[model samples]
Each structure stands twice: as C-alpha cells, then as structure tokens.
Target chain A: MFQVNADVIAKEEVIPGVFSLTIVSPVISENAKPGQFVHIACNQGGNFILRRPFSIHRIVPGKAFEILFRVVGRGTEALSRVKVYDILDVIGPLGNGFKYSERITSALLVAGGLGLAPLLYLAEELTNEQVKFYPMLGAQTKTKLLRYIDFKRIGKKTYVATDDGSSGHNGTVADLLNRTIHYIRPEIIYACGPEPMLRKVAQTADEFGVKCQVSLETKMACGVGVCLGCACVTRQGYKMVCKDGPVFDARDIIWDKEEIEPTLLGGYRCETAKVSDPG
Target chain B: MKNPVMPASGTFGAGREYSEFIDLNCLGALVVKTVTLRPRDGNAPPRLYEVSSGMLNSIGLQNEGIDHFIEHDLPYLRQFDVPIIINIAGNTLEEYAQLCREIKGVEGISGIELNISCPNIKAGGIAFGASSRLAEQVTAAARYNTDLPLIVKLTPNVYNVSKIAQAVVYGGANAVSLINTLVGMSIDTNTFKPHLGNITGGLSGPAIKPVAVRMVWEVAQTVKVPIIGIGGINSTLDAIEFLLAGATAVAIGTANFVNPRVMIEIIDGIESFLRQRNMSDIRQIIGKVKV
Candidate 1:
C-alpha cells in the first residue's frame, strides 16, 4: 500500500499497441503478489489526472515489477510514449490477488488476449511453490496470442487457442479448456481475461468440480476502495473491485442484471478480437 | 483542529473501504457517499471517463439507501472518533427533509451535508442548486427537519455560486461546501457516442481546482458562514490555497482516487506550512490572499 515514484527501467512494445514497462521500486516489488495490480499515474500535468490500473504481469522480488497494458484510450496512449528513466507515480500492489489452497497439486492457468498479464505472474508463483500447472493462451488469432514462448519456458506446455483457427484450436479458449479438462484433471483453475471467457471458464471449471479464481476488470476512478466506480455485484452485495478484489472467486460474482450494470464497456470493442496479438 | 481535511462525498464510499489504507481518525471529518431516501443502483456502466486533468463520473448517487446506512455503515463509522458528515441528496425537497429527519438522531454523525447539486442524476440533483430559490427551499426544508448542523454542498455548474451560497445561508444553513463537480461530458469518437452511459457526469480533479477556489473566494465574501472547499484538492498546497481563498476547510474529492493517503498528507502539509510561518492558528491565513 505504498505510493512511490517508480523509475521505468525498461519499456518495450510487447506487441502492437501493447506495452510492458519494467519499473524499479523495491517496496512495491517486495509487497506485490500474483494477481495484484498497480495503479499508475499517466502524467503529471492536469491533462492526465486519473491513474490507470494494470495487473502486475511479472515481478523480480525486492527490486522491480512489470506492468503490461494495451494502448486503449488517452491514458494508455500517453503511457505508451513514456521513455525509459521516466518516473511514474504508482500506488499499489493493490487488491487481493488470486487465492489457491496449499493442497492443490495441479492447477490450470487460463488467459484471454491481454488478460494474460496477471496469470503470467501467477504461473511463476505456482512454479516456485512446486505446483504442477499448464498454461492456456487464447486470442482471436495466432498473431494475437501473447507470450507463448515465455509460457513454454515456464510450464510443461503452453496450450494455444484462437477464435479464427489461426493458431491451435479453432474455437473459444473456454471450449478448448472444456475439451482438455477431462484429460488434465486439474485440481484448480486460475483465469484472467474478458468477462465472457472468464464466465465460460468458471462454468467449465464448475462442471469439472474444480475451484476457480478470476481477476476481474472494470472502469475504476480510484484503484483504492474510496471510489465506488469499480463496484461489482456479488452474491453478498456490491463489492469494490479496487478494494475487495480485482481477483475474486468465480462463484461469488452475481453475473446477473445488478452486476451487469457496472461491467458495461460502452462502445469499446473487445480488445481480444480486435487488437493484433503477437504470437 | 486536525487540519480540515475530509473525503468529499461520493468519492469516499462508506468509511470501511479506505480504512485499511488510511486511519479514519486522522482526518478532520469523513463524508460518506450520498444516501438517497431509497436504495439506488446508480447509473449504468461506463460510469466514469477520464478527461484532461480530471475524470467525469455519473455514478448517479448509488447507495443502499438510508436504512442500510444506519444499520450497516453507521456501526462501522462509530468505531472511529472522527466527526462524520453524512452527505444526503434527494429528488425533491421533501426527500431532503425526510433524510435529515432520518439521520437526525444517528449516534456517530456530527453534521449533515445536503447534496443539492449532484450533476449526474437526471432528476433533483443539480437542478436544485442551479436556482437560488430551489436551493434555499431545500436548505430550509432540511434545516426545519433537524437540530443538527446543516451544511449545504453547492454545485459549481450554476452561473452564480456566490448568489446560491448566500441564499442557502439565509435559508438557515450553518455552513456551506462549495463547488460540487462541474457538469461535463465526453464522446467516444470511434463509436460516435457519449462516453458516459448517463451521457454526462460531474467533473472533478486538478482541473476543477481553480474553479473551486474562485467559487469559494466569491462565496466567502457573499456569506459569513464557514465554507468547506471541495473539488480537485490533491495536496496540502491546494488545501492552503483554498483556505487562503476564504475556505475554512477543504475536502479531497478526486485526489482520493489517485492517492488514498492524500488527506492525511494534506493535513500534515497544512500543519507544516502554518508552523513554518509562525502562525498560532489556521484562521489567520483563511481568506488572507491579498489582491
């Protein structure tokens, strides 16, 4: 929960419109965990006041962490032009991260497009804990699939799925998971992606009797709990995604009309199907 | 006094949310989100859109209503010693009076901040504050309903903020909080549609700071009641600027989203500035800005 002016040590375009920034901030790096995120201030001047939130894509504990973001709107576009050594006011390692039981020996990591950000970090955490897992990367096409090479280096095998049959499987990633779950028999499922894909994954996981944790996204003003802009309806009540979770149990989300109100992306197109993903 | 630093209503939900990151007691006061007469789901999604130096939000005053606040939120807030100013808004004057009456005997509440100018909603929001007569009517109605201190939170969207401020004071408001979010909107050029689902929202953040300071200064000269300056106050310097412009206190709104510890930081900064100046009290600097 510390706010620091992090020095951007490295910045690269992971893919067209998508960026990865490696920041030097020991406090945040040391405190951050998988599935947690950082809310970054875009610029100092009045033009970009709101801080944009990004999941911690990766971390190098006690030294620095990485944030992966897509150039969606003004904030991300402004962030894309930031050069190395620029200071970013970042407050985070925020929200509760993914939760898994110690007894779970086998896990499945699922991601949709840029949604792969947080799960990449979670995969590393699971690796360190000796939890055997497989990574499933999904995109609209082969070119959109991100970090497959990276995932292969970490997991037993990185499964690829594409909506256009441009890569591995020809259907949605959740369909691929549904087909493979019987063979893998994973004890738990962890996912981060668009809501529809997440919902599908949650359903499939339930059908297989496996526990599932998901990282959710919403338009947030304050990434801390103060602003209720990012409220998500749960079985209990409206929960602040910035505070209660950016990560939550799939079963807890209502996914009904009440919950559906805040999840509206307006006219923003789905980034997965539209954005170009690098294989 | 604990350097007048409080969370602006709507920006700080129930006190429980930020309690983990901030000690509630450290603030001069805590202003909860607007509580209407009944539970409100608020506006549709796409509730927020970032603008030049701030963001526009049409949260539509969403809350669990007054009953839920009294039952669930009040207990949690009562644990903290900080003065609680419950911000209430209504679709009508009766609703405002009813809310004041309902909250009158609440154990932990120190005052009620009548929300006369919430710009997001389609109904009673900014409409009340846009006109001096309606603003006075609502203030008088709420004032008659309770014996508690009444603070009318004014909207900056109006042409004459000072005129509205004076009217509310004449109607029996003990104090006034200036510059609720200015009404603004954005467009999604790609889709050729308005950015916010509600079509418009109240704009807050650093961009609104100048407008707020000007309004506070104007209202200060027009009315003798204390003014709680709100809008775009992110640091101690901004708070001091407001105080110097004639605000007795300042509320942190959009800045709370950027930094949870902003109010505490502002409080610490004010004390430092006052101590450095060898001023014995903060009042010496209030409205001290020289032409």
Candidate 2:
C-alpha cells in the first residue's frame, strides 16, 4: 500500500448530503483493485485523528479515483466541505478485494445506498471480463438512490429497491433477492450494505445454494492490520477487516447482533418486514 | 540511535503490517503489541469508539501468546537492525515472570516494556499499575527473571502517577513509559448505549497529549530513570513538548494510523528544529523548558 497527497480534481453533490469526490492519485488508482478501499485523511491530527476509510468507488486508472460517501459523521461532514484544489492524504489500495473466478459466467451485484461505491468498480471490471451481471440497487427513495445510472452505462438493467416503493421493488434489495433469486439464479452473489441486509442476503444465498462475497465495515483505527481494532467475526474466529478484508465470503461471516438495518437515508433505522421468499 | 521516535505498544503490531509502507531500521526502537502467556481472541466487534479528538479502544490485549511470537513473528523481526522491545502483559503475576523468562532466551529482543497499564482486560492489567505495591511486585517479578532493560508502562488512570513510577523504579525497573491510554467511555447519541464492546476503553491520540506530558513531568521528578512519553503525539512539536516536559524519548501511537509517514516526518522536522535553534544534539532540548 502507498500513501500520497492527492489533489482534489472535482467534487459534486450526488444527493443533498451525499458527495462524490474525485482526486488525482495515480499511484493509488493504478494499484487499486475492486472492493479495496483508501483511507482518506479528513483532518490533520486535530479533533479527529483516525483517517476515514472509503471504498474505491470508481477508478480512472493511471490518472485518478473517486470516493462516494454520505455526510454521516463529523468526518464525512468535513470531507463534504472540501473544494477542488484542496489536498487529501490518501493511503490505499488497501485490504484484500473481490477475487474473480474464471468459472463464473453470471453474477448478481447487490448494494444498499453508499454500499454501491465498491460494487460500481466491481461492475466495470466484470464488464471488461465479459461477465453478465445483474445489480440490485436499494435506497430509501428515488432521489436518495445512487449509481444505478452508472451501472446502466456499463451493461444490463439494475434491479432497484426502495423503502418507499418509489422505484422497482417495494422493499430492501435483500427482500427482492429472496423473491427472485430462484428465477434469476446467478452463479454467485456479491453484496455490500447494512449488516441486516447482508445477513438476509447471506441467508438467501445459502438457501439457494449460491456462493456470495460481502464487503463489511466497522469502526476502524488503522486501515491496516496493526491495531486489530476492526474485528469482523467469522466462522474462523475474529479477522481484521482492514487487512483480512473489507471483502469476504458471505457464508464465512457470522452475522449476529443488531448494529444497523436496511440503513435507510444513511440513518441507522431498524425495520423488519421480511417474508421468506418461497422461491 | 536513528531518532527518538517509536510506536507505542499495542498500537503497532509485529512490525509486519507497516513493513509494506516503512523501513523498520529507521525507527529508534520497535515495540510490538502486548503479548500474553496464552492466546487471546481480544474483544468482540466494535472494539474502537472514535471520540472528538482521539479514540477509545478495548482490544483487551489480543495476541497469539509468546510461543506464537517466538515461532512465527521472531524470524521476520530478526531481519531489522533496530532494537526490538516486546511489550508483555499477563493475566497473573506468575504469567508476567514466565513471559520475561521466555523472552530472555530469544536473541533479537533488546528490552521489555511491561504493560501493566492496559485498561481493557480484567484480571491483572491496570490493577497492578494503579497500586504502588502491586506495581512494585510486578516490576520485581519481571526483573528477577531476566536482565532485560525493564520499562514499566504507566497508565494515567491513577490518582498520583509519580508514586507508582517511584514504586516501579524501586522494584527494579530500569526506565518508565508514561502514559498508557486513559480509562474512558463513550455512549452513542442515538442508541444511548456504550459504544465499545468492553463498555469502556483506553483513550489515546492527540486528546491525551497534555495529560501525558504532565504525567511525564511528574514521574520525571520522582525517578531518575529515562521516561518514554506517549500520548496524542502527532507532530514534531508534540514530540518536542514531551521532551521539554522531561521525557527522554517519545512514542507516537494513534498518529501512525493517520499517516504512516508521520514518524519519518517528525524525525526530519526534529533535525530541522535543532538546526534552527543552533543546537547540535537532541539532549540539549531534553528537559530544557525555561521556567
């Protein structure tokens, strides 16, 4: 991994509180892989010392990369206020990312809100590899949704899920996956979203006999393995999310506890209306 | 010595994680995580709770034990020319002595930082550091087993830290490092629940630097041993502040996670700081604060 002072190339407000920041970090971008993330310095060693970790949303290889995040914490709020010429100390191409298998012909891409960040890069890579992929995009409402249009430009149609039923399916993408996973039956499922959604996805994929990979998030100090603070519980005991993964096989994750649910509108909201899709 | 800049124990793992980003030989010393007598799984998920300026981590001294370190980690660390200081923690008094005896047989380790100040674990972590009697007993137990330069890492949770520093010194500690993370807690504004899995954690980063400097100055007054000051050190000026407060050296903890090059930058900045002041050596600034 390499750390570089990247100059902000562009900043755009995707939604009201959501931002897409593009930076000229050739070293990181060139070395980056899909599902791997970069640690962005929101402030110097002032009020907040930990650098905010963001998945590589998109890459302009040999030139730049983009990170998509919502104004959830004070750190992201500080990040949203940055202008074009500002410099950010970014350390990246960190952690193990998604690994593609040649045996796979079809795959299902699932995301919840900003969870779409890393999957967007994954989609582009899959497109280049001539793999047919279906993306399940979820949001609270139509305006709050992200990256479906970006997925459309790559290939195929996106399966949209909105909590308010403003879009395709009238529920979480996990609920949608349960409903249609049998009919669609992609070779493997890849997901990144709220923990509750991931739990539901893992369960659905298991029942349908589909392999899955998930990108997990936690309260991390070092975006490397040094601190061992960001522990992701799995069948094989505790693993460091920063080094062992931001990505892992979904079946291997032991998803217990109530951290967050469908994560509607970037808020940790718990709502349950799950009907096991008898598909 | 390359420079008086090293990572605080537990904040830095076996030097393998950062080996990709930095050369291990550039450090004044290499202090690994707090190794225990047995393998510890550490705390559950959400081991970290970030606050305004720093963070609270209740990692609970998670490690693969000293046996794993000797078999797995020692060979990789042997390649570095830097003096390796293993940070050892134990669940009991005998465990501390046993760990010292085991590490003494290892060829690469130059010193031992007895971690009596870890606030997360239950059995005997901060209990020993908080009480002068227990601190003295633990320090002596470690010293009796090995002739390694013993540095007792002090916590800031005590009422009078200087008393404990004096006790450890009297018990045969060669030097001291202050302060380990302060005992702190955080509650989620939304959930109204404790943020960390251990409910409370040790606070570290720039937030605790002032407390660390004050403790270093206090402990420096009570003992003649060299003090390695650690707390919220992020820049060269922060490191220099510790030295002026009577710390012979400083260890950077949370800042290493922010910018991996922070230690290197501080080394370069300190050189320039001395050059600007027309000083030839770092000792000129150590405890040189004007009254």
Candidate 3:
C-alpha cells in the first residue's frame, strides 16, 4: 500500500450529488488492481477524522484513477467541495483483488447501484484478457441508475434491472440472473453491491453452482486490516472486510449477522436490480 | 524499547494484518488485543461509526481465547525484534490471575497489560478501571501470578483518575497506560436511531487528545510508574505533547488507521525534534514539561 497526495485532475457530477472524481497519483494508479480500493482523506484533520474508503472505480492507465461517490455525509461533503486543483491524501491498492484464471473464456458481471463502481474495471480487464462477459446493472430508478454505455461497448451483451421499470427487467437483478443464468453459461460470476442484493445474488449462484466472487461494502474505520471494524463472517468465522477481503467467495460468506438496515441505495429491496436500456 | 511508538491494544490486531504495510521490527513494542479465557463472538454489524474528528468502535475484544494467543499469535509475534506485550481481560477477578499464570508460562512474551477498561463488554471491562478498589484488586491479582512487567491500563470514565492510578501503583503495577477510549454515543439524525450497533462505543481519534493529555498529566503526578500515554496521538507533535505532559512512552492508536506508516513517521520525527533540541536522551524530555 502507498500513501500519496493525488491532485484532482478533473471532477464531474455524473448525476446530481454523485460525483466521478479523476485524480493523478502515479504510484497508486499504476499498482491498483481490479477490485482493490483507495482510502481518501476527506479533509485536513478537523471534524472529519477517518479517511473514507472508495472502490478503485476505473484506472486511467499509468498515473490517474477515478472514484465515484455521493455526498451522503460530512466526509463526502468535504470531498465534494474540492476543485480541480485540490490535492487528496490517498492510501491505496489495498485489500485483496478479484481473481481470474487464464482458462476462463466467458463470465457474468453483476452489480447493484454503486456496486457497479468496482465491476467496470473488472469488465475492462476481462475485455483486455480476451474473455467475453455479460454485464448486468441494477438501480432504484432511471435517474439513480448508473447509466454507463461503456459496459455495452466492451461487453458481449449488457442487461439491466430497476425497481421502477424506468429503464430493463422490472424486478430485482438477481431475478434476472435466475431467469438468464443458463443462457449466459458464464464460467465465472463476479458481483458487488448492497449486502441484501449480494445475499440474493449468492443464492442464485449457489443454486446454479457457479463460482461467484463478491466485493463487499461496510462502514469501515481503518481501510487496512488493523481495526477489525469492518467484520464479515464466513464459514471460518469473523473476517475483516478490509483484510481477509473486500472480495470473497460467494459460498463461504455467512450472512447470519443481523440484516443491516436498507442503504439509501444498497438497501433496495430485491426488486431494484432489474434495469432496462434507457434507449 | 527504542522509542515509544507502539500500536495500542485492540487497534492493531495480532500484528499480522499490518505486516504487508510496515516492518513490525521497527516498533518500540507490539501490543495485541485483549485475550479472553474463552472465545468471544464480539458485537454485531455496524460495529464502527465515524464522527466529527473521531470514530466510535464497539468490537467487544473478539478473540479466539488464550489458547490461540499462546499457541498461534505469540510465535508469529516473536519473529519481530520488538517486545511483545499482551493485553488481557477477564470476566471475573480470579480469571485475571489465571490468565496471568497461563501467559507467565508462555515463552517470548515481554509483559502483560491488564485491560480493565473496555466499555463494550459486559463483564470485567471498565467496571474494574472505574473503581480504584477493583482496579487495585485486579492489578494485585495479575501481579501475584507473574513477575513479568505488569502494566495496568486505566479508563478515563472515572471521577478521580489519579486515585485509581495511585491504587494500581500501590497494588504492584510496574507501569500504567492511560486513557482507554472515552465512552461515547452517536445518533443518526434521519432514522433517529443510534449509529453504533451497540448503541454506545469507545471514542478514539484527534477528538479525544486534549482529554487524554489532561488525564495523563494528572496520573503522572500521582504514580511514579512509567506512564504509557494513549489517546488520539497521530503525529510527532501529538506524541511530544503527551511526552511533555509526563508520559514515558506513547502508543499510536486511532492515527494508525489514517496512515499505515504513522508510527514510523512519528518515531523519525521525534528523533529530529530531539536532535534539534540537542537532547541526547529521550529521558531528558520525559516529564520535563515547564510548570
């Protein structure tokens, strides 16, 4: 892991409140792998103490990367106020990254809401590696839906599900997976999103007996493994989400922990994952 | 110890998680989380919540029990050149003695830090540290079982922290580390619910530094034993503040979360500061705060 002062190369409010911040950090951008994340310091000390952890949304080649986030709290709010010239203190290329084998030829990319953040990089990598992938995106509505056409550009086929029928299937994305897993015949499945949606996706993967790798999100203190603050249970026992994995094998995850209250977006009922093309 | 830069108990796990980020041998000491007599499941989800200038945590000292520490965690730590101090807790008074006896027989262990101030657990945490009588009793129990350097960690939740420090000193504690996270709470404005799963947690970070420094200065005057200052120490300036306030050593707790190399940085910074002051020994500055 490396800590560096990344200059804000560009900023775009992809949609109101949610932002896509491109930053210049040669060391971190070059080393960051698919599914790994960067912890960004929100402010210079006062009021906001902990650095917020963000998924390595996309790597801009050798010396830049983008992180997508919404201004939900003070930290993000502080981050949002920074301009193009601002410098962000970032520590990254952290936790374990998603694993892919040379033999795998086809795969399914599943994401729920902001869960789409980590998978776009995975999709781009699979494309580069000569693996065909079917990308599935889900959200609460059309506006909240992360509309990225690049998934279709790089993917063999793209699928979407939203709760409001604002854009693909008018149901949960897991339901879409259940209905279409056979047609896709993917050799591997990769996912990221709210815990509730991930739980549902795990069920679908279990029924089909496909190997699924999931990137989890939790309220973390130290982005590193030290705090044991971001605990996720597996068959083995409690594991630090930041260390043992922000990514884990689908079958090994034990969700017996109490149901985390619905997230602003992650908390979507199973019905939200279905997305339709805005076109 | 080369310097006072150490990871506070529970903040830095058994030292394996950070092996990739930092060299373990560079630390002044390595203090592991509290070892219990039995395996603990710990608290539920939402165990952490970020607040203004700090964070609240309720991990509840989750551990695989003393057997795992002695057989598994200890050997891994001995690889590092740093001294290994095990922070231990018990559900009851006798359990403290038993734990000390068990660790006393173990090899490669340097010292035992009695954690009588964990706010999250129901038994034996904070309860003992909150009362001078119980604090002294727990210290005496551990001191009787082992001749190893005994350090009693105190909580700041009490009315008179100095009295408790004096009691532990009288009870045979060789050193004392003060202020464990102050008990705190956070409530979400929208849902009108508590932020932490446990409803309350121990607050740590820059937010608690002033309070920690005050308590350190207070306890330093009352007890002659070495005082290991812990609370909101993130930088060289913070460490120097604690040292000037009469701390013999300082542990980096919440600050380690922000920068993995923080302890190393602080260690380097203190050397520079002392060099600039033309001070040859760290003791020259320790407890030398001008009145």
Candidate with maximal lDDT: 2
Better of 1 and 2 by DockQ: 2
Off by over 4 Å in 3: A25-30, A182-187, A207-210, A256-279
DockQ of each: 0.28, 0.34, 0.28
* Predicted candidate 2 versus true structure: per-residue lDDT over A99-144, tens digit per residue: 8865677899999878999999999999888888999999999888
- Residue-by-residue lDDT tens digits, candidate 2, B1-291: 578989999877999978878888899999999888877777665789889888999887778888899999988999999999999998788989999999877889999999999998767889999999999999999999999899999989999999999999999999999999999999987999899977989999888988998999888788999999999999999999999989999898988988888888888888899999999999999887776
Better of 1 and 3 by TM-score: 3
Off by more than 4 A, model 2: A258-279
Candidate 1 stretches greater than 4 Å from native: A5-17, A24-31, A77-87, A139-145, A162-167, A170-188, A195-212, A233-238, A249-279, B79-81, B271-281, B289-291
- Among all windows of 10 consecutive residues in model 3 chain A, the one with the lowest summed lDDT is A262-271
Predicted candidate 3 versus true structure: per-residue lDDT over B207-228, tens digit per residue: 9999999999998888899999
List TM-scores for all candidates, in order. 0.85, 0.95, 0.89
Q: Compared to the true structure, candidate 3 yields what TM-score? A: 0.89
TM-score of chain B of each: 0.98, 0.98, 0.99
Worst 10 residues of 3 chain B by lDDT: B37-46
